[model samples]
Structure formats: C-alpha cells, structure tokens
Target: MGSCENQEFECKKQKPLLIEGPIIVGAGPSGLAVAACLKNNGVPSVILERNDCLASLWQQRAYDRLKLHLPKQFCELPLFGFPENFPKYPTKHQFISYVESYANHFSIKPIFNQVVEKAEFFQSIGLWRVKTQDFEYFSRWLIVATGENAEPMRPEIAGIEKFDGTVVHTSRYKSGSDFGNQRVLVVGCGNSGMEVSLDLCRHNASPYMVVRNTVHVLPREVFGFSTFGIAMALLKWVPLRLVDKFLLLAANFTLGNTDRLGLKRPKTGPIELKNATGKTPVLDVGALSQIRSGKIKVMNGVREITKSGAKFIDGQEKEFDSIILATGYKSNVPVWLKGSDFFTEDGLPKTPFPNSWKGEKGLYTVGFTRRGLLGTASDSLKIARDIADQWRTIKDTKNICNSQIALQM
Candidate 1:
C-alpha cells in the first residue's frame, strides 16, 4: 500500500471517524466565505484545502499585470472592504492581501495541504463519507467548493507535442520579464492572453497574438470610472439588444474590423454573455495601439506546429521561440462521488441557483461558475446561509424524535 493508505489504515483502527457538522472541500475565497457564514449561524464546518495557503491560485497562477477585473467595492468579502488607500482596481497582490485579511478577521482555520480525494453520500447512514490522503471524516453535509478553474484546458493542436519548444499554460505563467529577447507566441484572445501580450511587448519581447476567434475588447476605465460600473449602469436602464448594439458600435468605432490582421469580421457579436448580468469589462491596456504600431503582430489560429515554427490556418508559417497557452480550465470534482452525472455534461455542477448548486439535503457547492464580478463571493454567502438553516431544521427534528421516544419509555 502507499504511504498515505498505510497511514489512513493505522489511524482508522485507533480512532473512529469524527463526524463534523459540515465539511467544506476547498479553502478558496468561496469556501472561506461559506465557513464564515456558517460560523455566524452557529454551524460548525471544517474546510479542507489542497494547497498550503489560502488563495494560492491568485497568488501563484496570475501574471504581474493582473488586477481585479471588478472594482474593489464590489469584490470585497462579506463585512470587509479593501484598504482605504488601495486603488479602486486593486492589483493582484492587494487582492491577495485582502483575502488574507478576510481569513484572519473570521478566524477561519482551514486544514491546509489536505486534499479531499472522494466524497460519497451514504444513503443508508444519511452521512457523507469524505476521504482524503490523511484521514476520513464523516459529515452530515458536504460542500464542494471546487471552483471551475480546477483543470487547465490545453488544446490538442497538431504537432503541439512535437514542437520541441517551451509550452506553458496560463496557470504556469508567472511574469513577462523572462521573455526579454525571445519571439513569443501567445495563443487565445481572452483577458490573460491580451494582458500578457501587451506586457511582453512593453518588455521588448517580439510577441505575436494568435486569435482563433473574435473578442470584445473594452477599456479598463471609462470616463474616469471603472468600465464595470458603467456597464452595470447601462444594463439597468437599457435592453440587452440595445446594449449589444451600443457596444458593437463602440467597438467598431474604437477597434474597427479584423481586416488589419488579414482576417474577416465575425458575423456574431464580439462578446459572450453567459449570464444575465452586465458585461465583464475587457481591458484594452494598449493592445490595440500596440497592434496598430506593429509592436505586436496578430495572426490567425494555428493549423499546426512546424519543427522550427507554427503554421497558421491561412497557410502562413512563422517561427517562434516559445508558445504560451492562455487556454481556460475545467472543473475537477472528486472521484468517489459517482452521481456526478447529474452535473452539467461539461463536468460542471448543476445548482438550483443559477451558478450555485442545490446540494443534496445537507450538501452544497459554492463558486462552481465564473459569474461576473463578485458573483462567487455572493453565491458563497447564500449557500452558507442555506446550509446553516438546513442544519438547524435537521437538529430540531432529531431532538423532537428523541423527546417522543423518551416519553414512550
């Protein structure tokens, strides 16, 4: 047996499983917020995290130019605000600091380095049997706070594996200083790709942006205010179609067509609105100006990776020193839970709440969807409150049952 398995076996023989009120499976912003809410409602919960510290993804995966896409006012946790001196759009470090403060304020002591491997609902016992590498714990409720960014989505392009060059995903990306003199190819046109491309250009790296599809790029700030604030205001007063039209007009006026890059304008709208909420602002950060100035080159999607360079679908071949994949991530739920077929076909949890799940009985999930702005934190609070209420009802019913039995005796 493995070391962890042997340890678990030894522990099980000496000590039985400890039944906690609820076991939260992550210690991210969502999990920490949920734990705080449960504590407020007098419900005890144990948060288990795979990382050694809270907000590891924020501290590690993000690039240096990363800042809160949402304004600080909206991104703050429940009962907490960004430091008064911090900018309206806090940097990555500032955001991580705020998360640290939130955890400290709530006195949330999550078990770090404890990865929850499996969680199965025992119908007969009416408890969730959670297993990790260290030990097993039984809880009446299970909250799967595993966020959507669990699995990094790396595309399988032809000859990618044989490229014989450096390949890194957004998760592995750290800074732009390392790409000083190399010809870098950044794949994907999302925020990360856009931001990284701009930063690399400023650092004197010959960066080429590979756009597979069209995207709506917006300014980080609008009329001296955050773009998100402006979008929210417009969304409240205007219809979605009108908003789309206005945005399209603005984008066309500001960015024009993709013809400059030897590509055609997409028939569909530039932006993707998955939720009913306002638009998620896309920061320009001088990317367009750089492209216009020839500082950074824009190319079509990659058809294949040649031995010495990459081949575009347009029959053009360009040599590159490195390729950075800004591809997205996938949800990685535990394996022991065999009933995950109920989740979205893409492996994402299906919650009663638009982005939140209607966890079975005592079970709940927080921060599964990439809702706009502070949506994850907001969803976490609601789920925590619901779980607290359910726990109370369950306790009350159990007490009443015991009382009836005692009277019969």
Candidate 2:
C-alpha cells in the first residue's frame, strides 16, 4: 500500500484478489456524489460502474426534450454548481455535462464497465466480497447507489410480440422524430409518456396516449414561480386532501377534466413536485392542450395488443404504427445481494428510519425512495452526512482502542 500523509491507502497495493476500503456500486448521480464526498474527506473508496460513462440514465434513457423538473440551482451536486450558461432547467446533455464535471472535479476514477455480479459479506472477516466480471474487491463497507431506475419495466400485454411493429420502452426512446408521420401509441400516463407524446405531436406524428388511471398533473410553473415552490409551501401548511382539491381545481380550470376521456380526477393530494423519481405525478406540459386541440387523443389502458393494433380496457380498439411503453422501472437489487434478509417484504431495502437503511451494518442505500425528483439528491446529502459521521465514530473508537492497548503494554 502507498502511504499518504502517514496513513496507508489500502487499495494502493494490488493484491492478487484483494482491493480495499469502501466499495460504491453504480456511477449515477448518487454514486458520483458519494464518491465526490468520500474523496473530499480523504476516504479511500472504489466506485464500480457497469457502464463506461457516468450518469448512464442521462446518457441513454432520457429523451430529447427532457429537462430537469427541478431548477438547475437545486439539481447540482454538493460543492459543485451548474455552469453559468446552463439553463435554469438543464437539458439531458447539460445534466450529463454537469455529472462529468463533478467526476473531473473530484478526480474520481471509477472502474468503468465493471459490472458487479454479486456481493457476499464475510461476517468473520468483517469485509464484503464483491465479485465483478473481471475482478473481486474486498471492502469494509458497501454503498449500493445502484439507484431506483436500474431496469425498465415494460407492460406485458397479450399479443404485443405479434404486433410486428416498432415496440420500444421510454428508456429506449430518444426522440420522436423517427415516429414522424406515423400513428403512435404512448402507453402509461407518467411524465415520460406525456413528454414523449407531446414530442411526437410536435414531430407531426399522430400520437395517442394510453392512460391507465387518472393522474394528477400540475404545470411545471405556476403563477410565475416553480411548481415545486408552490408544493413545498402547501406541504408545510395545508392538509393533503385540501391540497389535492386545490390542484384538482387548478387542473380542471386550466387543463380541463380528463374524466370525459374515461380518466377520473384523482381525489388524492397534489402532485408532488420535486423531480422525476418515477413516483411523482407526471406534469402535464402541453399534453392536455395537445389532447384538447385534437393533436393527441387520450385512450384508456391497453387490455391487449392486437395484430393490427391494441384493445383498450374500455373496449376500444385502435391501430398504431408504433407503441412506446412508459410503464416505468423495476429495482433489481437482488442481482447483487441475493438472500440477504435486509430488504423489505416487497424486495425494497428495509429502512427502519424512513429513508435510511437499517438492517445491514456498514452498508447504506440512497436514492431508493421516490419522495420526488429532488428526493435522490436530498437523500444522498443526508446519507452522505450520516456515513461520514459513522466513519468518524469508528475512527475515534479505533484510536481509543489502540491507545488503550499501548498503555497496557
């Protein structure tokens, strides 16, 4: 190992099979943020990423018109602000640029393309054995920043495979230019579905949106202020039901009631505005206008896909050239930590303290709960602080133990 400021950097010496210190899985925004913090604190850690680039979601899954639902000022990583020229709401490219900048700023050298196959904790040794495709790393702690959007979840309707048309998930959808002049069906009523549908309309594609349930859609901006500001204000003072009523009234007055199209106005609270954490209601950015203007047609959820088209649960059949499944994503945590009795009954990590993971010692998960768009970043900051405190406590305890041993000798 190499000495740095009189302390040995564990990973400096390349053993036949052992690498050291904390191991971070995933190189997304959360992973990068954690790495940056660790580096700043002089903590020796290794980040294992499955992709060659950081923020693979931004580089791959994001659509062209996608903008940060949260303002850039709040969306930035800790200690790093967005560029001066960046828009208040940055585009996908701008977000990726910011992530790259963060990595460069921190000098974080993550092992690119190193997919973690599995991880097992050696309780006796107090080390986690993380196996990748090419190498195995032993670390005292593991941070599963794999993120919630690890895998895309596509709806499995009957006869979808037989359609013989272009079937792609929103994750694979880059732009709507290719669907030009074609009849398109956007499955799901999430933000991605609405955004893609709007893009399709702009691209001259006749787009139809499949809404399975009534979604509470709010404007990105309200009363010259960000919708998130309004949400934050309301969440503090107003009751959830009252907030829902106010939002519903606003939607009806502005976007019109989608109930006539077989979708009901949700009686729930206002759409949580933060960012696209896959849980917050999709903001209705011109989708309602497009629908009302006859640019896009709203349809019920798909019952089954047919050879020619699809059959909706409402008994309506329509033919389309392409189907964009915006069904959402699945958290594949078991792939790495299978048989671990730490996850919730629903397979999510069990967090006794709300958003903080509790079952595993020296292990933590961030960005798992979809509190909203800013939820990941917010949770990341909290988790990072908590981990730092824990690390400091351990170091202090070790120092005390060493001093006591020396005194005894």
Candidate 3:
C-alpha cells in the first residue's frame, strides 16, 4: 500500500458518478430532439435509455414495409434535414438510419441500459432525483421524452383466451411472409392495421381488416405530390374547415367511390378528426387499391371470439388463422411518476391532451402528447426554450446571492 503503488489501486476503484444540467430519459427521436435543442442553446444534457441503442423503438419494432405517412420535409428533426438522395417518403430502414445519423451528428451519446424506475422532485434541493435500478441521478431539470409509443395497448377481446390461433401485437409483427397463406384478421383500421393487412395480402395471406367506424383514408400521393404537403400548405392560407373540404374533394377525385368500395367516408373531415381526437385518418398507401381489387376484405368490429373464429358486431363470424392487434399505444410517463396529479386515470396528461410538454414540478415531457415527427420537433423546441429560460433565472439568482455574500464579508 505504498503511495506510488496506491495510484494503480485508486485507478481501479469505482468513483462516484454524477450528472449535472438536464437529464433526458428515453433516446428515441423525441429525446434526441430535446437533447439536440438543448445543446444548440448552449445547455448540456445526458440521455438515459433503457434499450441497447438510440431510437430502439424505430429500429426494432417498426414493420419492414413502414414508411413515413407525412413527407420527409415535415418529418425530419429540427435543423437536420433528410439526406438529399432519400425519397419523399423514407422507408422504415431509411428513417432508422436517419435517426442514428441524427444522434451521431449531434454528438448525443446516451447511457444505455439504465431504465429510469422513478423520478422524484425534492423541493429542498430544487433538483429532480431520478433513480434507475442501479444508480441515482440528480438533475436540475428532468425531461421525460419517452413518447407515447413506448407501451403497446391491447384491447380485451372476449373469448380470446380460448382462441387457438396465433395472436400478436403490431409492434411484434415484422413481415407477413412468416404468416404466409394464413387468414389474418387485423384489428383496427388505422395506418398500421391497413399496412399490415396489405402486407399480408401481398404474401399470399388472406387479409381481413376490421373497420369499426367510418374511416377517412386519403391517398399517400395525389397529383404527384404528398397529400400531407398539400394539406399543410393549404392550412397556412385557409381555415381548417375549408382545408378539410378541399381534401375531401381531392380524396373523392383520386380514390373514386370509396363509399361503394366498403370505405364510407367519415361524417367529420380529416383535419377535424385529427384536431378533435388526435386520431388522424389513415393515409392510404396501397391498402385501398388492394381492398377495391378484392385482395383485401373488410369486417366490422369484433363482438366475440368464437371457437371457430371472431364474431363481428353484425353477427358475421369468420375463422382466421391469426389475429393481429394494431390497437395503438399508451404513454409510459404515468408509470414511472409517483403521483396521479400530473396525469389522468387513463394515463394521459391532465393538463391539455397535446401540451404535456409543459409539465409542472420541474418535470417536462417532449413526445408523450404529440402525434408525429413535426409535433415532436415542435415540442422539443418549446421545452428547450422553457428549460433554458428557467436555468437562466437560477443562474441569475445564484450570482446575486454570491455578490451579496462577498459584500457582507
């Protein structure tokens, strides 16, 4: 234990780990966006991720055929545009690569495998205590960027326990080749359900889509331009109602007799549906064509799971070899937080639906409330600006206290 020999011993010993500045949980696009925004504003942040890599949800969970519903321009992160050679609608693999590149470009090195178990705010210290399984981290600001898609929500289907067929969530579904030639019932007529049904049809599987309500399915590209792009442009110049009417005309002109083809247009317009309920209409890629071609069939909502198959609300029963639930996801924030004041009983933020980013008690969330990449980008910028403003006040107060102490001495 000589002093010179002790140097090697000290080098091997574990040192106390600490992180200052802001602590961002979850390294998905939302988290990455917040971290990038903070860095650009001269504030540093440490990202803690439960998974092995950044953007694990996109890299691991998305289907092979997934593409951005919105155009690339609207989906890219703030200040970092998509690659020049990429298409208008980037594929799932391309989007994953873009996320990876975005993190690398921003020099965001997230601490992997540290799943945040609890977050507590201490008023005495004016800091947030974030505890993982193995360590404790304290931060002046806690940004929970673990967006809405972190947890998959499965609806309770009656008699599903007795069904002998394969059942899986859309998150676990990769390709349809593995489910070849099987009759697949895709529950829910959202984008994922529509796309999965189409995938199953292409792979020789008999695909049946459950459209429970009037669905607003718009063509992905109309008149050689993205319908989303056109809608966004129209939104700037016109009211939402007028924009929706224009979109309805465009849909009727492009898709042609969607009502006759089993797709009855919703009573409400697409923009209204999205704004009122955050549930946007599905942007039809090729599912509509497949449905019109008789390659894909439509069914009503599931009434019960019979021994033979599922019974729809219309008393129609059909046997399927497999059931795929594309029911969507819930945010994981309310689980990690201790109290119920911040969130509702359904785990949604009590504070408006989409403005959960403006959190209280030193807790902020980025992507939990919003719907798309553009929403994530917008949330991240606002959160960063708010955090920066608060930090400036803290610094100013500290400086004033120090000056008074020096004068007294």
Candidate 4:
C-alpha cells in the first residue's frame, strides 16, 4: 500500500509467454463462442478471464427474473444449442447452466482471474503483446472477445454522491426483495429497466421508471409469434422500412398508443433505430401491463439526487428509498487495447458489423456486432475459419508446445 510497494509492483516483469495460437481476452459468451469455434477448426486458443468464473455477467450480474429476450435457439453459441428440454426462453439459472455446459463441452479451460491490463500489436516482432496481471503473452493472433457491455454505464447525475439512499446499477441488483416495499426510482427505459421495474412491482414495491429519451417498446410476442422472430423472418422478404411498418402497426394494434402512457416511440422505425444506434427496443414481457395499470410510474430524467429522493427534469420532486440504474453498458476495449485503428474510443470496432469482426494485424473482435448472440456466432466462425486457414498456410509448428500454457483441448 506504500509508495515503495507500488514502485516494486510497477517494476515487476513477467517472462514473455509465447502462445502457439491466438490469445483470447474474456470468458463470456462471446469468448466462449470463438474458443469453441476455434477448437472445431482444428486450432486452439487460450482464453483469459478476469473473473474467477465464466460468463460472469450471466452467472453473477443478471437479475433473478432475467430470461433470454430471444428464443434459446437464437441465443445459442457458435457450435452448441441449448438442451432440448430447455424452454424457448430460458431463465437466468438455465442460461448459466447452458453456458457452463457449453464451456465444459468445448473443454475450454480459461486461465481465471487473469485481467488483461494492456494488449498491443508490435509490428516489429510480428506478434501481439498481451499483458495480464500474472502473464505477458506473445502470440501471432489476438482476439478481443470481451464484447459490448464490459463495464456498467452509470450516468453522472447532479448530487449523486450526496444521495443517502442505496443506489446500485443493474449489475449489482439481484432482486427487488432486497428492497422490500420501498419506493424505487429506476433510471432508463431499456429492457433491463422495464424488467427491473416489473420485478419490483412483483415484489410489492413502488417502481418509477425514467424515460430520458425516445424508445421503441414492442410486444415481446405478437399473436403466438415472437416479435423478434417476425422481424427476422420478414427482413428477408421485404425491406427494413416495410418490416418496421408491419411491426409498428402490429404494436399499435396490440399495445395501442404508448405515448399517452409516457412511453414514447422513436421517430425512426425500431429496426432502423437499432441499426443506426445500437439501442435495442424494450421487448415488453410484463412491464407494459404494469405501466398500463399505473403500477409502475414513468417519469422524466433526474435533475438532481437528494438524500431523500430525486428532482425530475420536469420540475417535479419525489421521495424514494432506493435507486436502480439500468443505464446499460459499454465496451472496455479502449481502456486496455493499445490501438486506435481497430476500435473506436468507446471500445467498439471502428468498422460496422459483418466487416467489424476482422481487423488488420491478425486482430479480431467478437460480440461487437450490435446483432447480439447471432452476431457473436457469425464473428466467431469467421475468425476461427480465417485463423485456421492462416495457420494451415503458414504451417508454423516450431513454437508449438513451447509455452507452459498449451492448448489442452
């Protein structure tokens, strides 16, 4: 804790650990998908997870009531499907079980608790230098699979520190039972925000959600068909506009006018808005009815947070016992990856999806594709195939089995 210890820690050096294949950073679904795909391609990779367990977001951060927004099939990783008995939309626990099984099935043994501090491609050495807490890895290929949502995106509110109430991000929130019958102010109107509010309502808590910007609220399903399913099926037949029109018409008929209920729709179509901006529309499970019945109050953005409650930008003040920030997450790629060419300042691939998976200098990105699991699968397969082709062409096996960390699987 002293200056001397800090200096020594900074001065400490790790032997350059050479990796035969690609070095993966992260052990989440994205990382798992790529690792599995790579194994299938006859190539091996080393996955490094900062956390002790795989899929920490799903295993630890997810709420008790969380379920796959999409069907299980659509959410499956690269080379695996959810168990046949698993429901169309598996619950939080079921998804975690699937993730563990997926990792085990692939024989993935990620070095746990190895936080990637920095990763840089050295043109001189023709390799990537990945520096973690315990290892400095050198490899011809480096895969950034941390994906989107690496870190919680907490908003900067005036007087937030002065608030006496228990304020926590959705990452830390597990259940509304934790708050009992307290008045909870839920910020953001995204899927997580809506679901969290719905959960609070079930727990007999008064939940107020904040709608700071325009959002698209579509029924999770429409007439025995999943809304997302319909969108995907229709996109192939018609243009995005027609698909959006049908969706809005269906939404208008099913949910009626949400504007009067304080949930405003964006001017652009849901699909269009999502394509332009990675903001996904809230797939209402039960929150719409709660909002309709006035069980969950919708309010404007907060102007300031007081000890008792928060003052809304609409010039209104209300008291609350706690605050739940469903403000969402952003990529942490920029923080550690030492480059500006491949990724943006916000930590997403500079290139868009489809093309976003591959970068120059043998660097690849998975899960940055706003397309969710489907995108992750696409990126993973492409990366694995490309790496396999390159490896076969080079036929470089001289350094194989040289590193202590061998590709066990």
The sequence of per-residue lDDT tens digits that candidate 1 reaches over residues 42-161 is 877788788888877787777878888767887777666788999877999988888899888987877777777777877898878777787777777788776777668889989988
Name the regions of candidate 1 deviating beyond 4 angstroms: 1-16, 253-272, 276-281, 334-336, 351-355, 397-409
Candidate 2 structure lDDT: 0.74
> Cα deviation of 19 in candidate 3 (Å)?
3.2
Write down the RMSD of all candidates, one decimal each: 4.3, 3.9, 4.6, 6.1
Compare candidates 1 and 3 on lDDT and give the better one.
3
lDDT score at residue 362, model 2, on the 0-100 scale: 67
Candidate 4: the clashing residue pairs are none
Q: Candidate 1: RMSD over Cα atoms?
A: 4.3
Most accurate candidate by TM-score: 4
Candidate ordering by lDDT (highest first): 4, 3, 2, 1
Give the whole-model CA lDDT for all candidates, comma-separated: 0.73, 0.74, 0.82, 0.89
1-409 per-residue lDDT for model 4 (tens digits):
1111001233245756677789989999999999899999888788888998989998878999999999887898987889999998999999999999998998888878779999998989899989987768888899999989999999899988988889999999999899779999999999999999999999999999999998899998999889999999999999999999999999999999999999888999999998889989988898999998999999998999998999999999999999999999999998999964788889988788779999989999998999999999998999999999998866655455444246664
Q: Tens digit of lDDT per residue, candidate 2, span 1-409?
A: 2212111233323332444457788889888777777666656567888988888988988888898877776677777888999987898888888899888898887788778888878889887778877666776677888877888987678889889789999999988899999999888877888889899998999998888876767777766667666766786999755766676676677666677654565545544332222256656667877877888888877889988799998898888899999888777778777547776544466653255543475676765765533555666566567667767888899999999999999
Best by lDDT: 4
lDDT of 3: 0.82
lDDT of 2 at 270: 48
Q: List the residue pairs that clash in candidate 3.
A: none
Ranking according to TM-score, highest score first: 4, 3, 1, 2
lDDT for model 4:
0.89
Give a tens-digit lDDT track for model 3, residues 323-363: 99989988877778774377665656667645767767778
